[model samples]
Target: MNRKNKIPKFIFYMIALWTIFSTAHAEEIMPKAFVYTEVQNSVPFDQIPWKSRNPIISSQPGFISKTWLSGSGNNSVGGIYSFDSIENAKKYVTKFFPNAVKKQGVAHTSRIFDAVIVEKASRDIGSAHFGGKISTKPGAFVYTEIQVNLPFKNVPWQQRNPIIKKIPGLLSKTWLSGVNNTVGGFYAFDTLENAKQFAIEVFPKTAAKMNAALYTRIFDARLVEHASRGMDSPFFQ
Candidate 1:
């Protein structure tokens, strides 16, 4: 080989080392992952033996916190959860969680979100888990997601704020956007009745206006506070 064509040994080693360091740094800063799930046509929240499973769930890889949600009307049950990383979030949703619920529910749905990216927008709406505090009074929670064509950055979070603020009994909301152009939020409300009204009668209309498919559920926040606190939920703290 011609001497002129040869690369310097030091330069080559420097580039190699930099590449390795950069990759690891990126992973370190990767955002926390969020997961939401619902089991349809299931038994009432009181009947489900979630206490037996809390210890097992806390033991999962990358698990951080979780808040159980009971459906306002359908006897459905689900949870709003957080994890240390996106990979673990998807793993639980696709593999572990599904299998765990199979005996009790044949139909279930789940979505994973990138929590860090939307932190600012979520906070704007009173996301207690992010930094705000949930109402001291008992409350219910709502989860809603819609399909969209726009990228996450392009979604108009500000424009939707006015509409959401008008919701009666609303205390706070944490916005969410995830892989495959999904938009959604976790909402806290002062009363179960108001949450049911929004989930069943209000949010669907909003989704239709956006021309996107909607997925939503209402959970009894008060019922699950203890289990959630046990899992290190930020809201409880």
Candidate 2:
């Protein structure tokens, strides 16, 4: 289809904006963004400017780790935030996020969810892990927000992993699906072009074959910081 969502020309501007600072321990995985219905007591706060002026979000209760996207248009705003537990994750969205927006003064609307990490992989293009060395440079990734048919079934990881392993330039893929059945994945690529190419070439056929109702968004993602116990290369369809 030759689809394109170009990163802003002001490249460095995005590098400055997409930043995530977090800490994690092994054996910790929690829910996805569960749209918080209640306003988390905004109670008077500071206003944060746009990207390039991201407020330093420190580690706190429920805060485990996160992945952020920079840029506009093709750029995304929210991120994958892991918490101590599903309850803790929900609390953060209902409590922390409202206040965060108030103090940061950033316009954001969150659809909270509690998702489980069904699979994680490091495409073999490079060592893609949950946690790794920190870097601020802009990187590219695409994650899908989808709904799958009941009795979800697809090609076994044993078979799919081999296929993805052969594709060139995939950094990593973290599969997450909400309890409500929202399915998607977090992926990192060497370039935005590569990410889009992957979205068009691989996802369509695979998802249809699996009967998964899916859609994808490519973004300028960054891995500011993380803590991992080991590497997971399971390819989830």
Candidate 3:
């Protein structure tokens, strides 16, 4: 082939490869958005470093939302952290909970889920007063890995939305199913007691009715940042 012809072909190939790479990694690492979560049993509030809140965090920079979740068990703690960049998320975790990634024991399970969808609230539930940093007391992040028998597309959306709209203290919900038949979701609640109630009272009858296996965990969690999607997305309000 001539030099001119070869150059055009090379440019085409380069563009193709870049497109593929970008699409593949788009959801895995959102445009400066990531979710970090950890779940353990009965993590004491004193151990977490980021305590006491100042309203300035939301005003100072990029997205920031933080809260403690409540699950059915009092002995469990699961923390959820999100940030504008992967570097920021990692730095916060390393600086405060340096040992957060390690396995403390059989009972303690710590995790960080960076691949999550940030959704917006459906109702007029949010205000500037309610916004900003509210991680006053350190608590656990609750995570339940749900695998329903039905495909995500086939799940009952009409029934699910009504229940989600009523729950309070639920900061964020992540719908984590890709092109697979089985789907997953990660929820960041403001309090463990509310999380526990939802898990026990709501999830069973609606979301996990046909699930073959259900996994639940908790951790000592701190809210590093909290930025979520807009009201356009379809989820519990």
| TM-score per candidate, chains pooled | 0.80, 0.57, 0.43
**Candidate 2 residue-wise lDDT, 1-237, digit = tens:** 223234454554666554321222243432233232222222211221223323343244655445444432423355545554667666666677777667755456554444333433322222233343223232566666556633113414446566765655665655554545555566667676777788878788778976767767666543321211111111110
Measured on C-alpha atoms, candidate 3 has an lDDT of 0.43
Q: In candidate 2, how many Å is residue 86 off?
A: 1.1
Candidate 2 global CA lDDT score: 0.47
- For model 2, the superposed segments whose C-alpha errors exceed 4 Å read 1-56, 71-73, 98-138, 149-155, 222-237
lDDT of 1 by residue, 193-213 (tens): 998899999999988998889
- Candidates in order have lDDT scores of 0.79, 0.47, 0.43
- Candidate 1 Cα RMSD after full superposition onto the native fold (Å): 9.7
What stretches of model 3 exceed 4 Å from their correct place? 1-36, 39-41, 47-74, 85-142, 148-159, 166-195, 216-237
Higher-ranked by TM-score: 2 or 3? 2
Q: Please provide, for model 3 over 1-237, each residue's C-alpha lDDT reduced to its tens digit, 9 standing for 90 to 100.
A: 599899999999999999999875443223233333444455444443333322322232333444344333353444343455555655555543445435455333323333322232211222111122233332334456555444545655446555665676565445433223444455546666766666667666644556456655443333222211121111111
Give each prediction's root-mean-square deviation over alpha carbons. Answer: 9.7, 16.4, 12.4
lDDT of 2 at 12: 49
Our tally of clashes for model 1 stands at: 2
* lDDT winner, 2 or 3: 2
